[model samples]
Target chain A: MEEVLRRQIEKIVTLTDEEFRFVLTHFTARTVKKHQYVVQAGDPAPNDHFVVKGLLKSFYTDDLGKTHILQFAMEDWWISDPQAYHNKVNATLHIDCLEDTQLFFISIDNREKLCVELQKMEYFFMKKTTAGYIALQRRILSLMSQKAEERFNQFIQLYPTLLQRVPKALIASYLGISRETLSRMSAH
Target chain B: MEEVLRRQIEKIVTLTDEEFRFVLTHFTARTVKKHQYVVQAGDPAPNDHFVVKGLLKSFYTDDLGKTHILQFAMEDWWISDPQAYHNKVNATLHIDCLEDTQLFFISIDNREKLCVELQKMEYFFMKKTTAGYIALQRRILSLMSQKAEERFNQFIQLYPTLLQRVPKALIASYLGISRETLSRMSAH
Candidate 1:
């Protein structure tokens, strides 16, 4: 179990066993049932969760009672409402478990402490955040230029687990396309 | 001049004068004229600019030859085609100056070296990137759920500088709305 987590951390940045162990001590293992709310809109977002298995999605419900997906996390992916978690503000998004999930959860305080205590951890998180920012920026560009079908296809290619677990309507909404449009595109 | 830049960096993370000077040295200052292209689609994104004054917009032209705005940057904001800048990929977005602008430009190589040479700079960038990610996620959520009018209002509230400088048609495209609708909404 520890080795698996170590490998995951290694993928981001190199860390000696001692540093990894030190960082791991602060996180607690969490099990979430399918449909369980890892987070809720309007509540303060907790620290990041490192997924070991299953799936989770960060989303929000609109004034019109529509759900819009912000991000989907599967095994080995991390999920959190970054603003709420980092700034200790009320979350503007909800994170829900799409499957029975196992995650390693760290608090904001603990994560900061880890960063201070382990330079490698700080470097890892910094790289991860940079990569995440790049991905989000590109996605915005794609949304601006690509058709709904193109976006849907890219979504499936990039995150197949989300496509499988999430309903088509929700996916359409996430893609900023109407359900009818998504359906029509899928039929083709 | 340095004081303003120092304050901007301080808002994100604390940096000693020595560290600040060290990181600042890696940046090369340049002036941009109004309506000039900083970078264009299909070209390599080189310099990530720290805007000292004036305005710029990052956008993409779709297959239909319609330009869609992605982001607008004004004084004190950092602007770049993140993917192309970070990964050294050919850019698919174009960045153009809306006004005569002063910027401190840093290449990715220099950025990496700065991070290594100055720990405080790394922390500052990490925090800034995290904040940027959170903002982008919120924007994506808004795009998914909100109507064009609501988005336009939010956009104006959040980025008044952009609303003031960028054309209404580009803002309409940014909100994925028709130019006529933007005019109607803004007139109200």
Candidate 2:
């Protein structure tokens, strides 16, 4: 599990064994069973989780009580109520395990301290955040494109792993399409 | 324009006089007339622009020839085809000036160089990117919320200045709604 994290960081910045050990000290590991909620709407969600194993999703439930999937993470990916965790606000989203999950979670304070201690981590995070921003931009483009078929195709191309792992209904929710539409699109 | 950038960066990381001067060296300032484009779909877009004055909008044009506004920036905001700028790819969106614009633009090479030479620049970019990611997440939630009225309310609260400066059709485009629907909603 630790090596999973090490490899993810190494993709951006190399770390010495001692430095890797130092980074590990800032994170705590835990396991969550399938169907467990990790972060809930209207609650304090103070940490970001890195998936070492299994699947998880974060979603928003709007005033009309309809749920919208924001994002999903599997091994080597990060998940959190980003606004809540970074801005120190109560969450407006809920995160739950889609499968039995093993993960490492880090608080924003510890992440900041680690960055100050290790500038390389800061660069890694900057690179990661920029990449994440680009991805969200892409998603916005797809949503605004208003072609459900184009969106489904783009999703599969970007996250082929997700297509195999996440349920069709959840994928529809994330794509902002109805399940019937997704079912028809998948058939094609 | 230089001071506009200085204040923007200083909001996150304070810099000395010499340091700020070094930062300015990497950027090139320019003035663009209204309706001019800084980036166009299918072209290579190499820089990110910080708006020192005026307004701009970045939008995606679909295959069916409809345009959807992805974002708008006024004075003190930044605009770019982020994926093209960061990933060195051809653009998939067009960014054009909504008003005669004065701006400072920086290439990715200079940006990376600035980060390497002055580590503070890296932190500044990271903080900006993370905040950007959070804002995009919020937008995604709004888009997926499936309530046009809620989306309009959220947009006004977040970018009240835009309502006065931008055309209603563009605002409707940004919110992924029809112009007639926006006119009706705004009347309330």
Candidate 3:
């Protein structure tokens, strides 16, 4: 599990074993069963979780009780109520394990302290955050401009493995499309 | 204009006079007239612009010729095609001035070099990018779940100055509301 995190960091900036050990000290690990909530709406969000194994999702539940999928995290992906974590506010979204999950989590203060201690870690985080920013922008564009079919195709192309992992209804919710529309598109 | 840029950076990380001057050396200043594009689809996005004065918008045009406004940037804000600028791809969005605009722009290479030379700048950028990621997430939730009236009200509350500065049609497009719906909401 630690090796998975080491490799993810190494992809951006190489770290010495000593440096990696230092980085490891700032994080704590947890295991969660399927359907366990890691974050719940209206609760303070202090940590950002980096998936060591298994699947999880973060979603927003509207006042009408409609669940809108915000994101899915698999191996090596990070998940958090970013606004809540960064701003020290209550979460507006909830994150739950879709499969039995293992995660390494770091609080915002510890993450900042690590960045200040290690310039390489700061660089790694900046690159990761920038990439995340780009991905979110693309999702926004897809939601605003793409039709249902186009969005489904784009999603499939972008995450071929997710189709098998995530339920079709959840994917439809993520795409802001009806499950029937996703079924028709997937059939094609 | 330089002071505005300095103030924005200082909000995240403090910089000495000499360091700020060194930072300014990496950027090139430009003035653009209203309706002039800083970026256009199909062109390589090499620079991210920091608005020193005036307003601009970034939008995508779908295949059917429908335009969707992605964001509006005013003084003290940064705007770019994040995917294109970060990934070094051709622009998919067009950013044009809504008023006579002055900007200081930095290319990816120069920005990376600055980060390497000054860890403070890297930290500053990481904070900015994270805030951007949070704002984009909020926008996604609004698009997925909010009614047009709610979205418009959120927009007005978040950016009161923009309602007066940007044209009504663009604001409607940004809110994903019809112009008539916006009119009705505004009248109320």
Best by TM-score: 3
Question: All models: lDDT?
Answer: 0.84, 0.93, 0.94
Which 10 consecutive positions of candidate 1 chain A have the poorest summed lDDT?
Answer: A1-10
Q: TM-score for each prediction? A: 0.94, 0.97, 0.97
TM-score computed on alpha carbons, candidate 2: 0.97
Task: Point out where model 3 deviates above 4 Å.
Answer: none
lDDT accuracy of residue A107 in candidate 3: 97
lDDT string, candidate 2, B1-188, tens digits:
68889999999999999999999999999999999999999999999999999999999888889888999999989999999999999999999999999999999999999998998888898888888999998888878886898899988998899999999999999999999999999998
RMSD, candidate 2, Å: 1.3
TM accuracy, model 3: 0.97
Quote the true-contact fraction of every model: 0.73, 0.88, 0.94
Error of 1 at B54 (Å): 1.0
Q: State in Å the error of residue B163, model 1.
A: 2.9
Each model's DockQ score: 0.74, 0.85, 0.89
> Which DockQ-derived CAPRI band holds candidate 1?
medium
List clashing residue pairs in candidate 3.
Answer: none
Q: Write the residue-wise lDDT of candidate 3 on A35-57 in tens digits.
A: 99999999999999999999999
Q: Any runs in candidate 1 off by more than 4 Å, and if so which?
A: none
Worst 10 residues of 3 chain A by lDDT: A119-128
**Candidate 3 lDDT, tens digit per residue, B1-188?**
78989999999889889999999999999999999999999999899999999999999999999999999999999999988898999999999999999999999989999988988888888889999999999999999999999999999899999999999999999988899999988997
